[model samples]
Target: MTTRTLGRLRRTDFPYYAAHPDVVYLDSGATSQRPETVISAEADFVRADYAAVHRGSSVATGEATWAFEAARERVGAFVGAGERELVWTAGATDAINMIALGISDASQGLGSAELALSAGDEIVVTEAEHHANLIPWQRLAARTGAVLRHVAVDADGLWSLDEMRGAVSSRTRLIAFPHVSNVTGQIAPVTDVVGVAAEVGALTVLDACQSVPHMPVDVSALGVDFAAFSAHKMLGPTGIGALYGRAELLDVLPPARTGGSMITTVTMDEAEFLPAPNRFEAGTQPVSQAIGFGAAADYLASLGMSDVRSHEEGIAQALVETVTRTPGVRLIGPAPGAERAAIASVIVDGVHAHDVGQFLDDRGVTIRTGHHCAQPLHRALGVPATVRASASVYTDIDDVSRFGEALGEVRDYFGVTT
Candidate 1:
């Protein structure tokens, strides 16, 4: 929680910062740097015990399966989900797609009636959602004859709880939104939205990709029907993520993917699928990646999420202060001193975001540029692109200072005058 503890966290746990001592990494919103424990966990598993899980009754298979399932338990518990409620997918994008595709199947009378979307049913999303959350529901609405509506954002790229409530109506079937905006770093009022969804008998799906890593998130506590997040963003390996659904809902929702491991019995004519998590996990699983994901969860748990949140809060404040003090730099999302995630996306008045990124890169400061996969959000904000500097548990005051110093020079370096 102190500066000393933050220093120890970065130096002792993360090797990426040590290796690139001069480079300031401020892109943890896109993907986090892994701890040594996570890297070792994956390598150690592959080196000592590598086998196809649940494919056979061999000792190797059993051991591999145990490790894989145990990883699932860790991740589920980390998110306040029962083990049965978590389904592994390729990543958060894939997880959202799975839910959309499964709902599409349900609309076609393939799964439980409760999840079925009939003609004229409405699906609501926010204007600030990342494409992963937006596009999937767009496809689902198109496929199911459901109407898609969105809660609009203001000039600052934020939507209010009242705006969200206004978007929902009697015909609303589902409400899908992000826990935090990937572009603007605005934290959505999740509990308020969940309450609104419940009032209308609408299902809630949360894109927790940005929130789960930076703060404490309990899917059950939030009362969302389903939530998705990726491991890579949370200091774990790529190619793995989790979809959390209520037990009863997951039990009935059809698996979007069908293959070998997820089956209970296969016939020439039909197949009976396993329940919940297993039914959703088809084909060969990401066994080693799951182990690494579990290790990442353990590492964060050891630090305590409360402390992690506290550390990032300070970083967020520093980032806001830095951006606000710099002339010709427009800070997106919440204003100075407002609560937000540890991400700062800004637009330099005269320079393109890519040019700003290049300027920073030249100064050994790393940041994300362009629309950051939320083109609609950028479009709404009336900008083509913006540069984003995000922080993680490993990011310190010096990192933010380096970013600030580099950013303050961006206009001068480009010969752009206010």
Candidate 2:
């Protein structure tokens, strides 16, 4: 199999593909296999520089803190954010919750007036959002008495900017949505949506989990107030992710989780917190994982997202054409020739998605099957689950061809004539 369009990924760089010669892994949507550089970065840091960050003043602590902040800078640069804009969290779930919970704190009059969410205000989201983005806002609205509204998706699990305009209003306080859909791979109109939020004086929160790793995403360019993504999705460690906020906004917003490292002064009753990132990062930080994720971001920057995007575009096109050309295989999301990410979720006519996934797995073509944490979108599409095959920089034409040919044989293998 040929490397489709990029140069930074030699199969040797990724230990998983190098070790397993026969497997065609197509599940990059769930998590990408870590490269040797990212893996080695983590191991090297743990071996050489493992120490508690932002606590002690010892030499070892200094080095560890330096590495941690260096990672923050590297990752910030990768996402077009300033050093002060990032706050590391457990993952995207935690990152989004950080913003939601902090806003909830505002609703309680515990934070600055910028974040205050009163009873009459509203929050806007899209129907194509993952549960990670959807549920938190639902909780946010419930907690603050704010109205929660969603831009509906069409039959293919896609929504348009015009539809989004209809959903937003002058009373909107926050607009939470995804940059790219995890299930359908539809890229959102970030600039336009941000403009929409701006006109209404609403804040924008982006679920960048599906966008950050696969493409070159600039938080500044997108004009989003806050964006969240995970390290695991970007070929780094699993337990770490980041929340990027506008420096000014984060400065005034209260920390969601409070404790030692995040606070400046603690009295017997009240504790005054730090600013921005320091305020948000509560306890001991994810030091080694942050280093690894920085290395991962460095790796992607080295490859250049342009090459990666080119590689995936070809794969996306092939996947769309392949699935749609086969009978009883309904391609979900934007049709071929549309601006989509490297993801294809399909509903096979006669077989369940789980069975389709297992059938492909037996043939050594690994794919993800389920609601993909997007049950609302699936419900909109009139399906319970879908077989989702997503591509990454390492995915090649041979892997693409294999999945298509195998998918064509699924109906016959299951012995269904309908």
Candidate 3:
């Protein structure tokens, strides 16, 4: 393999191992590679501070409890949310499920909220959502006898703002979409979308899985009823994620998964639930992961999200230019130089995405391939799948250049180039 070995990543201020001089990772959109600090933080918790959080009695437990809540405050500060509004879950999928399950419980008489769903009620989503955001809404509509409507996307996998505006009517009860489409890399105007939904008194849910990790996010400014994202994508451990909801709203929503920790009191026939966050957390929380995630959030903050965003944008721009000049390559999503994230999904003519990925791999370049969990967006763009190269804060110009060089050879290897 042609090696693009940079050197020891420790030579740089960025905590991640970017200078391996042997690897060029480009799949940050799916999950980012962790820094040494973030990785060690998780290990530190298990090796030393392994007590249960929020419900323990021992002195060690008390210290652990303080650490746990401190982690909550850190995450809250990073995302522009408050401790009262945040509920911990397993991941973005788990968080989304929590919201849907809570709403479903409300409709099914488990909650205090006046959630009355009929066949005429509608739940709106976009064609560009990951399955995590789409499937839950589909299940909610199925269970509530509500209709599901989707805002269509353009040929570039961009959803029309006008169509989304039209989709919201009196019948629309809830709307859900991603802050940034994972496949397309296009940043959605979240405030605009939420504003429209708010106008009609519809609840809004945002899948912030892509945005929270890459850019500075202020959930308060988004003005949505709920938002969810995973810790792993943001360089934390896999088992922890967060769901942010309005304190007043979560107060009325019922617990989805019930057990020991989530209850206030229990009787043989009836049980009273705890407050918003604890009521939803239910079982043994991901205490160690939360501690580690707090460290990750702190690390990102230290670097400043502004710096990280600018670095990845530079890589994306360079990758876009390289793709445009390469033969038989069609860039997916918005055109190059458009306001986008670090991801670039592209199709190589006469080659399956898997083959393109394999070709890149043989040359020591790592890029993500396939539908990227947004199959609807792929279909709308008229491709079965695409090879996606996503950069991260640690990614530099060399990695992007390697990806471009490898991609330029793909058409020739597949006999697509004249």
Collision pairs in model 1:
none
Model 1, C-alpha of 33: deviation from truth (Å)? 0.5
Candidate numbers sorted by lDDT from highest down? 1, 2, 3
lDDT of 1 at 116: 96
lDDT for predicted candidate 2 compared with the true structure: 0.90
Candidate 2 C-alpha lDDT tens digits along 307-361 = 7777788888888888889998999889889989989999999899999999999
List of clashing residue pairs for candidate 3: 5-21, 5-22, 6-21, 7-19
Models 1 onward score TM values of: 0.99, 0.98, 0.95
> Each candidate: what lDDT?
0.92, 0.90, 0.85
What is residue 68's positional error in candidate 3, in angstroms?
1.1
Pairing residues by index, what is the TM-score of model 1?
0.99
Worst 10 residues of 1 by lDDT: 3-12
Where is model 1 more than 4 Å wrong at Cα? none
lDDT (Cα, 0-100) at 393 in candidate 3:
70
Worst 10 residues of 2 by lDDT: 1-10
